[model samples]
Target: MKIPIRSECLPYALILSFLSIIFYFLNKYIAILMLILLAFVLFFFRDPERTIPFDEKSFLSPADGKVIDICEIEENEFFKSKAIKVSIFLSLFNIHVNRSPISGKVTYKKYRPGKYLPAFKSHASEINEKNIIGIENEYTKVLVSQITGFVARRIVCWSKIGDTLKQGERFGLIKFGSCTEIIMPIDTEIKVKIGDTVKGGLTVIGVIK
Candidate 1:
């Protein structure tokens, strides 16, 4: 199969490859190192297709990574009600592409500036820079947040308020390793737990009741 890379990464890959070529004429060892780095960057932006769940009540994962946290917290920013937050921490090796958890219209979108902490930490959810998206249909409202980790500084989000998104459709990507969170209704059933591995748009994270 062809390498499934994101178009957003082409500029980055090109610049790095050019540098790698120039360095190759000067020092073979340094050029090899640059090539390796280029490979990693290419891998980081890979966007593979996933089979989305068809269940009307199922809420798919918004990102690919290990579940770092699962808890019930007060969501004052958007829902203004209690919600079950599921945080997924993406490692460098995991796909950084983000997808919609369900088919709906984006009702809310916001970007916050803050400190860059390790995403695996619980505190990072509150202090780190992030982008929050709220999607809603006639059925329900769900919120998903894209958080930047210590190594991830750029968060790209294509979703905007009033835009429609299909379940498991690619919406954006975070550069390098980071975290993404899904806030579902507390009454929804939680399928995964802390430390569980999940694939974005593929894993059924919760069920709508």
Candidate 2:
């Protein structure tokens, strides 16, 4: 059977597995603890396939989490206009993999290093370490921000500027709990509200009007 875990997990899995084996020979109880951690590492990195919707006008959620905030904001960084921002807060148990919300060519990419705070805090979005990616289809442009939380320090993005990405394609992941924000045109018809649970690539976040 194919391993459902992301490839980025192999090194951590191998290290934990090796430590568990070595501890087994020296201390049984410690070995058991290592084994438990190994299981958690596997679970945390699991990447199951998702069914992406085919509608061209709807944009999917970029991360699996709960919608924490949705409001109008002036997106001067990319869109440079009034836009709707939807923020998703991912817990430790939520899937960390991030997906593209629409099929488009990567037009912008920027990485900012900053403070680490709890992702649920409103100010965290502005001060936390983050990677910003802008995908533009023929119709509209969408920006995805992967923000690191107190426990999440690593942000991985595989797609780069000028690369073409299909709707719901895997692009990157946060190493632990984090936050993801999607900024769309002001005319976008928001489909999710705050506190709504969402699945990356599976939940329609908004409709392009």
Best by lDDT: 2
Separately for all candidates shown, the number of backbone clashes (residues 3 or more apart, or on different chains) is 0, 0
Q: Weakest 10 consecutive residues, lDDT, candidate 2?
A: 1-10
Identify the candidate with maximal TM-score: 1
TM-score of each: 0.97, 0.96
lDDT tens readout by residue for model 2, 28-129? 999999899889888999999877886779889999999999999988978999999999999999999999999999999999999999999999999999
Among residues 3 or more apart in sequence or in different chains, the pairs in candidate 2 whose N, CA or C atoms overlap within 3 Å are none
Model 1 lDDT, residue 163, Cα = 95
Q: Model 1: what TM-score?
A: 0.97
lDDT of 1 by residue, 48-155 (tens): 766687666889999999998899999897789999999999999999999999999998999999889998888998899999999998888899999999999999
Give the C-alpha miss distance for residue 70 in model 1, angstroms. Answer: 0.6
